[model samples]
Target: MLRGAWLGLLLTLMATPAVATSMNAFRERAVTDPHGLIDAVRQQLDQAGIELPPARERELLWGMGTAAINSNDDAALAEATLRLDGLATVANDPVAAAAAGFLRARHDIANGVGDGLGEALKAADKVLGESDPEIVAWARFQLCDAYALDEKPAKALPLCRQAVTAYRALNDDYGIGDAENDVGIALATMDRVDDAAATYERSRQYFARAKAEQLVVMVGDNLAQMYLKQGRAREALALSRASLKQELATGRISDALNSSADIARAEAALGRHREAYEQMRKVVAQARTAGINGQLVDMLKVESRLAEQAGDLRQALADEREAARLGSAVDTPALRAIEVELEQRYAAREKELRISELEHANELKDLQLKAAEADAARRREQQQRQRLVNTTIALLAAALLLIVGLLALLLRAQRRHAAELQAQTLRDPLTGMANRRAFQQRATELLGSPREANAAPHVLLLIDIDHFKCINDSIGHLQGDRVLRLLTDYLRTAVYDCCFVARIGGEEFAVLCPQAGLAAGMRLAETLRAGVAALVLPQDLPVARLTISIGVAQFDGTRCHDLSSWMRAADLALYSAKSGGRDRVEASKLAG
Candidate 1:
């Protein structure tokens, strides 16, 4: 029964009008009416009666695949790519095979397949040396996108430029738009913000002119994000809202959800926290229903921050914990390993390509050398020998120089990696502040030096979040982590640059204020306490008002001889404050 059904379908396709239509007809319609072309090809693939040559059939399928990709029809694209691959195999056409592979790889990448980038890169590399200018341009554009996905913007930028130049030469406005968008992304990643914005604007204009509404919306979203990063919340909000409306009208539910999230972020940035929180709630619910865990996690994080801003601490804590759980589930070691493997494969393929080019150059050199030897044969043997000797010396010198340059680059990369690791070690991962070791080391350095006669005494403030353990127990460790991070933000803003703030223990932070007196320390501690106490949650929540207890101690050489002794005095005062009442400050009285 299955065999009969398959035979019937094959007969139906063979009898279609597409088989009778010329490839030029499809190609002409591809630019102005890609959707119509895709629909026509799809219908043709469903009917029967005509007999076309294998090459013609392959061309039809290729046209359909390209049209489907342009129209963003995944089902049609998949069908066309599958058929084109089979036909290309039967006809032994490498170019057609490469084209089919690239389409399939791009589709897979869009759907989040692990090896898609590697496959795309491989396919694009295959067609890059093709004689067809359009094919070469398309291959370069695909390469740029692949590199951008791999987070190598510097590598992607030049490829994007090349693609854009090729498209301009072909007068392919749609292709130019696509390449320009990629160029913008590469520029943005490299932190060339102004250049990126201008490129995106150009892309949008090209897309608009090409009547690619979907791509225009995509560019709008990119521009919105850039505006948000630049603190232009009003403009970001406007653009995101417009994009969201367009996405919804076009029935792009996933894109609409992303746009909504952007809108919420813009709202939050503009101080419309309640509106942002409510908006994100809807986005999170929709993302969860769609089972997009990666997007859901991101949306949940935005929602959590919005909740926090709106004084809904309970909701904020719940959202944070949920986001963390989802993130952990989505971010698996196996997934990371696959990503790394893809990157390694890409690097290996690039190395292979480079090696092939070098080998080809050497082959050409060998041919030239043979010609030279032939010419030298007509001359003196001694002159030939001297020429060969000079050539050998120059080649050896070039090889040595290349090797030295590579070694220098490797050494520099290793040094940069080591420096990053060192910085991470001295920083608290959760709070992004100095750790206990760093804090103690810095304090010791300050105390060991002799004080100037007119220099103000250094003061230390030891602060602990009130009922932080209870917060962890009630909300979970994930929320506790969020609280710590939020508190760190507050502390950073509250203290001056002259003060060194560090998270020394769980729920405990120390501030070492240089050139501060006992009175100044007490005043700063009171300000911190009041600031924390002002962090009130929603009235209906079970959580109490947030608060912190502080202990202030001024450096006294007569009473506290060393850094350890001075810290002990602060600890004593901290204990006194905790004993007196939480959310209060106490100063140490050192004996003169």
Candidate 2:
């Protein structure tokens, strides 16, 4: 036995009751012999009988259930979880109940993957608020896992941080290290890889100091994997080899085989390809011997990659083919799904327990009179499970409805944002008027509008600011902008909203009048020409005056020419006006 107060005290319990003795042995095994504890507990449970099953299950579940959850072994957790739930029900021990509830929540998370996270959170909260400090610390550790499973790293990180404070308050190194390990998981999930690596290192130190070698191995694997990710392959290889050597010495074939793969990866990273190949070959051989198909398939893949790198094409191809054959032959998903379905319902159990108390209060009186306490407890357990199923169904339906509502809101907001963006795209930034694109679109809409044959004629006015370049050269573009704004003010006042005004290009504006003919068009053009001619400017302007040349073109629906040809005709007319004189309106002559 190790020279330690706790271990020595447990060593004194060798002649105690089987459950009592097994617990101390289990505690000792947890620190020193990770692989032996499960069988030890099972043997203890068998020897002790039904009366000792609850305590046996409770302690074993905490120690072993944790390893199962950590390893993501759904089968072990599912089996342990069922037995723990039974124990919690019959024993009515708060610590056992809390452990069962929290472990069940972990089972729920692992089973659903993500679907049962909300329920996991509720279960975690239930146990975290328990009166037992050790139980509370353990619940907090599992709560951290729940948040990670929830895919909310931000939420998980803060909870782990708070758990560290709580664990420190209890002065428990094991709890503190577990809390730190969770913090590393959260940090890794958030892609704070370097910080996660450092946190894992700190956690390993604590676990090692507390003489928890299993935890040290677990944390060592995590840190080594992180180091490999960061390309610190030499360090990762050294650390994994040391930890793996210890696992092998303890005869933990499973843990050793698992770590061997990681060490192989580290070797590959360090460019020791042949060494990596041999290490993974060892892993594949062990996996085959053990007949663990999941491990076999993964190890074979790793071996194949290593063999390929080592130029052993025949061996690589053989492993690859075998892996594929086994993978296809195995129908794992169906079995896994069945397990998941059984495992995912633990969250609502807490709610069911509370509700069952009130619903069976009167029944409890009759059961007491009949003196069937176990029967009453069994009845309550069954009722609680049934009610839990009902509540889970209702909650899932409400979640579906809420998701539909949120999706609808998201789509509505997306459409509104698109509309606002579209509007901004079509407007001129400087002039605060429609751009050419908006003008063309609106004109297309209006001309395509349904109208009688006798509908009023429409026209296009192409207006150019005359002597604008001289103004810019004399006073600068800033004053020219002021002059353009002034002229815009005049155009707005004269033609107003009835006509669409667009600044198509530099100092070139277009007006589209839908209800105006040649006569009305000429009048609007003359008004616009006279309005610009009468514009006043600041004394700082080079030329103290501004004017515009206008070209008015009437639509010939009979000819039905494109807008570009129409603009061409108006452009010719504008050239004629500039030749005729500045600040004048000209009409395009139609070809018969």
Candidate 3:
């Protein structure tokens, strides 16, 4: 029996290279024109005049199966998988039969849930019993994949680790790397984020050492996606862009689309809004053309957000509507029926689980309730004894109130008088504005401080009534006071939501404009300048016209230039304005 088996194996080994060459040729052709290659292979196999050995015939069927899978033509795959399965079964080749069965099972699962997962497991077990370590590792990987697809990654992870160990024992670096990549994905889904990233890096290093460019590209993309989830946008952006350029050069359109999507997200994070929008547009178009409903739905939603960032609300809404439409259209009648069946099964299972949990909870609650009842009986006796003491305490408190009432009134009057005296000191007395001390204190609180991301930068505007002494001497002091009040009204009105407005000194007012920066401050100063210039000061006031010189200072978003420094900058700029003949807006070097 051993001699016979050795002879059979010799013959099979001699025939293997020719069969493999044919399969490889067909695979290469299928990459560019899968349907044409499929049709040509089918025609050759169907020809009655052609005679081929069994091994070569099996190779043709396997090639056709792979091509069909690549084409996403389910019917063709079904036909090829069935023929390969029957031929391998009769040929008594466990390896060939296992591979054919596994492919068919994966195809079934890819389309929807199928009955062949058990069969796939059985085939994998047969392969595991074989002597080839590499083949056993591959079978273990397939088993891991089955568990992963069933949403049991924790079960799959041990198998994945075992596969990696087996591959390492055989010095199969490529196999080890691919298995580790699988392990990383499982870990990531298990929420071990740091472990997943480290595993991915290890896999990437192995692929790089092996000079497997395609595998390296795949690993790089996976790592970049992980970085995005970690909020490391800059790193993700760099890796994605580099990999995308390489993938595009290699004609990997699908991979390029995925990379482009990643690039969009990173660019948006980096504030390259328009570039991000363009990248997302290309991704949407490619996904739409590919007729990939899930990718299309995802890309459209991303595109909608990009549009919103670009301030194109109409386009954003339209994209959202289209995404919604596509999402609804993805649920075909068959898929909808399957979903409904799953939902029903889930509900029934959940109801049973809830009942079991509730029964357990009720037993615990009953024990606690019995304990509480004993405690409550003891508390009732204590409550009855405390009631008699409460009435005695209330009578004593009423008798003490009469003794303290007059003293409380006199103390309240003195406190009121002192509070009024303190208010009078902080007041400007003339224009009802905050005095200089109060102005400086309030300005220090609002300005000269770092602002939050959503908060406004602080701006300080210093106003000097141009030639105020002239106005006071030429017009009486009352008229000058009226002019100051007129300017005060403009300052309060303009700087209401602008934070603080005060008269820091006579004829010099300060307004702390929170959240306003250079351009905003300049515009405001120009407005206040224009507004005061345009003011008639009322025909009743002694002054015919009023003009003001102003200086503006704003925080540079770093160290808060203390209020004094900010004031000095504005004061210097104010001096420049005065020296340059007044009634103008000027920004300090710090402002620029």
What digit string (tens of lDDT, one per residue) describes model 3 on residues 1-592?
0000101011111112322422223433433344776787788788833465555666666666655654556677688777767767777766667667666655543333343345456556455446665456656766665444433468768877877766555555566676777777677778777887898888878767756555566567667767877989999888888777865654444456667888898899889999999889888888677554545666788899999999888989999999788656544576546544643553465466658765686577556555655555555455546766766545544443433444456555765787688778777889888878887787767654555565446777888989999988988788889888889888877664535788988899877776666777788889989999998668777676788888887875443357767888888878887877988777776654
lDDT of 2 at 101: 58
Candidate 3 stretches with Cα past 4 Å from truth are 1-83, 92-94, 104-131, 146-152, 245-253, 293-592
Q: RMSDs, each prediction?
A: 22.8, 28.3, 25.2
Error (Å) of candidate 3 at residue 87 is 2.8
Question: Which TM-score value belongs to model 1?
Answer: 0.48
List the pairs of residues colliding in candidate 2. none
Q: Kindly state the number of residue pairs that clash in model 1.
A: 5
Tens-digit lDDT track for model 1 on 489-553?
A: 88998886568999999999999987677887889899988987886554544566788899888
lDDT of 2 at 553: 86
TM-scores for the candidates: 0.48, 0.44, 0.42
Error of 1 at 444 (Å): 71
| Model 1: pairs clashing at backbone N, Cα or C within 3 Å | 12-47, 12-48, 15-48, 15-49, 15-50
Identify the candidate with maximal TM-score: 1
Off by over 4 Å in 1: 1-38, 48-78, 99-113, 150-152, 208-217, 288-300, 311-592
In the range 1-592, model 2's lDDT, one tens digit per residue, is: 0001111111111111433513222333544454465556567667777666555556666565544443344565576667776776777755555555556654544333223344445445455335555455555555666665445678777767767766655555666676787778778778788998999888878778777766676667768878888988988888788767776665545556668898899889888999999888878888677555545676788899999999999999999999888665533566446434533444455566667764586465445444543444455455556764877655655555565556556656865787688878798777777888888888788777765455457788999988788888877999888877777777777774457888887888889987567787888899888867776766665676688999888777654366767778788788888899878899997511
**lDDT of the candidates, in the order given:** 0.70, 0.66, 0.66
lDDT of 3 at 448: 42
